[model samples]
Target: MSFRKTGAAILALVMAASLPVAAFAEEEKTIEPTEVTFWHGMSNTQEQVLTELTDRFNEENEYGITVKLVNQGNYGDLSTKLTASAVADELPDLAQAYNNWLTAYTDKIVPLDEFVENDFDDYEDLVEGYRAECEQLGFIGALPFNKSTYVYFYNKTMFDELGLEAPKTWEDMLAVGEKFMEEKEMPAFGVDDLAGFLEASLAQNECEYASDEGALFDNEAGLETLEYIMGLYNNGYARLIGEDDYFSSVISTQRIGGYIGSSTGVSYITADDFELGVAPLPTNKKAAANQAGTNIVMFAQDENQQAATWEYMKYLTSTEATTEWAMKTGYLPVRVSAFESDEYQSFMADDITATAAYSQVDAFFPAAMFEASNAVRTSVNTMFEEVVLDELEPEDALAEFVQIINEECDVE
Candidate 1:
């Protein structure tokens, strides 16, 4: 199915008509320089690029805004700190947040509708998929920042030597995986996130993991998805890489032939001794990939800080900045204009692996959302372990899993 455009249509309806002329004409108040503090979870190369860009914005922007970025380790740490800050009434002016974290602070976070309606002029330039992702829950909770999608990473050296082609469907994955297991005496596919895999697999079957009613993965489609995965494990064709780096395992061991993982991790997939190939996730019924990454969310602060935060947000997501981000990092650009830019074209030309993700952009979908989204994912992972490692029947495991998630989410 085509990527859902309903969110975009709703946003257009809510933001299309310009406000009264007086509303636009009466904005001449001179405010003092504002210092907007930002909390983020970037480290290493990503942190370096973000700091460079923030410094440029501070020194060059027309608005007198000084952005102070505080790296809070990884996303989990940032979310925890943000929660504590919320309780202490000490939240930063802005921070990078995933949908689940944003949902937790929805009441405390400021909606960008008024700011976008009045200040930003290039809303249409944003990629339709990323824009829809921002508005996935019926409103723009945050602006798209570093975005990525899932891709199939395979050992091209092995494929060529074995005269094997990349799998194009679930059946193909099973057949290829079984062949590798029998011939090579090793697992062919390794996955770090079973929940993410389930999301993609469900979408292929035209199903979803959650709904307004409750967890929806207890049906025939969900069973088939789990059974397919279990079949691979039972036959020694697949393995879950728990507490291990997938890329490193794939490279160091050189046992597994391929796996489905994030495009953001592509940079770490070094293959000096062999050839590494990246492709879109294998399809079953329809082509679908789960969109991954955090968005820049603004907390409700004073008017000046809010204004400054929006300026920085716009700058970060601008075509030029996003193109730079995509070039430096493995993440996808958040803007359609960025993808069309000469800079991005050159970057993609040099790194064909990065281009694999862009091809699946049209099929990207917002990940499953709920108040207890992370918890639900945890339960799904647990179920995967029970079924794959413990060898529990798919139907029995799914029944218990559905009950647990529905109770945790308080679904009627």
Candidate 2:
């Protein structure tokens, strides 16, 4: 080492030794100027809002953190890239993540407990369901980004004219469809996600979904869930997106009574000549609905990088930012305060679709995150297709499903 540098280091150490330990300990913490790279898969209006938020943070943050966004296609493309980057230790500082992907790379993720508690002022305002879902590996490893839940969107005018109310149970749904059968001369009920229908229906019927052991939805409740879904399709009462690629297509044609879809479906739907209304999914054994969308996760990095990345994470989830995001995008706000804010209150007053789904946020449930979670989700979709579209017996399809998932998700 250079003599001058060595002498300077020694002198600095001597100076530090002269200060009282208590005084040094009391010094305030500070952040170094940092450039945080964020990876995400948001597109369209979602992408525009994300950029606006990032630009605002870059311009307004006191910590001198410059956040550069890396837009990585859609969620599927993002997941494929993340799988490769994680193994190579080349992950961006932070990225949007699914719990399954986060589970797959738990060792590489940085827990956010410290930041959630110490740096965030609105920690207590976060919705409990999303907060609970973020607790991974016994610590907060991710934060809800663009959350949504299944909601029943109905043509209020037609429902009222037919003397039908928003269904309160599976029985109510089947009974109400009869009225639509008389008028529409077509299937009036639909669900956008059959896999979601299976999972959420199973949970509602008091059946466990899956776990480290194996697939759990092979019991009576599981059979009943499949039978219910099959009956809807076979009876010409309901359809799925897979069946016809329909939802907005049907709604735009004014041929739908109602459908179950993510709250974000509000963006694509218009009631046309009918008055639109949204309501929580009808319940059976429980009022459970499956939550959708992803969260933001940070990778393990140097202390400065971690701190700066965390700061941005905290900002992204703050009440003001989340409220503004929900107003601009169709996503549900993650914070209760954000939803309660006067601006959002006014927004929802006009946007009844959002208001209805927000009422069921407490009922939202997350799927299990395991090594083979993504694969199992695909299998569930296949199971639905086999039973509903291909006319496979529910029990036989379920048996094959259990075997495949047990082999794939059997964790060590």
Candidate 2 C-alpha lDDT tens digits along 66-156: 9999999999999989989988989999999887875567888888888777767767688888887888457888989988888988888
Error of 2 at 315 (Å): 0.8
By TM-score, how accurate is candidate 2? 0.89
What C-alpha lDDT do the candidate models reach, one value each?
A: 0.81, 0.82
Q: How accurate is candidate 2 locally (lDDT)?
A: 0.82
* TM-score top scorer: 1
> In candidate 2, which residue ranges exceed 4 Å CA deviation?
1-27, 242-246, 392-404, 410-412
In lDDT terms, how accurate is model 1?
Answer: 0.81
Candidate 1, superposed: residue stretches over 4 Å from native: 1-31
Kindly provide the TM-score of model 1 when superposed on the true structure, using C-alpha atoms: 0.89
CA lDDT of 8 in candidate 2?
A: 98
What CA RMSD would you report for each candidate?
A: 11.4, 3.8
